[model samples]
Target: MPTSLCGTWDMISNVNFEGYMRALGISACLRKIALKLKLRKVIEQQGDQYLVKTLSTFKNYTISFKIDQEFGEFTKGLDNRHIKSTVTWQGSKLTCEQTGEKKSRGWAHWVEDDKLHLELYCEGEVCKQVFKRNE
Candidate 1:
């Protein structure tokens, strides 16, 4: 099994998030606000269920699901889109596949060197972000 990805993480770097937002058709105004906010992630697991929260001063998004099971999700504060999502382990990465209006939209996460790595993708644009454990 891969290292557990459970804890609070503070983002240290983010790249190409604007391009990914553009693919999601986010308003330029919202994108600008999102860009300036420092993001954090809180991951937790219990039994077969998992919860992941993307937090920031501007907005926050949360999702909960189990591996290999499909669930309904509303993007809520982010894009306000409804979609079906499934999460599964792919090698060392925990990947979520979001099926909705956008093509190839999803996110992947893994931990290495005590830092958490995330890749958020929509259409063809990918945003890479790295976070260190909050503690």
Candidate 2:
């Protein structure tokens, strides 16, 4: 296996995020605010559970669960919706499937070339984000 995906990562690039936000039904004003904020991902693992936090100056969101176990998730600061989320390892990629009001919603995280890569998708829209490990 590659290095553990447990560390602090600061985003260096974000692409097509606006389209993804629009797919999530986020308001234009909120999308604009979200677009301006730099995002950070803090990943941790304890025993059989994993915690992934999306952090920003304005807001933070966290989700914790064990692989293959389905759980309920509330996107409190983002889209403000309840969803069923399940995370599983597909090869080196840790992927999540979110079943909610939106169609084709999910995200994947993996390490490539020593950098962290994230892909967020909703309703046929995809947002790709890349982050470097925080030193």
What ranges in model 1 sit over 4 Å off? none
The runs of at least 3 residues in candidate 2 whose Cα sits more than 4 Å from the true structure, single-residue gaps closed, are none
Cα lDDT tens digits for candidate 2, 35-104: 9999999999999999999999999999999999999999999999999999999999999999988999
Clash count per candidate: 0, 0
Q: Per-residue lDDT tens digits of candidate 1, residues 63-118?
A: 99999999999998889999999999999999999999999999999999999999
Error (Å) of candidate 2 at residue 13 is 0.0
Model 2 — which ten-residue stretch has the worst lDDT?
1-10
Pairs in clash, predicted candidate 1: none
| lDDT (C-alpha) at residue 43 in model 1 | 97
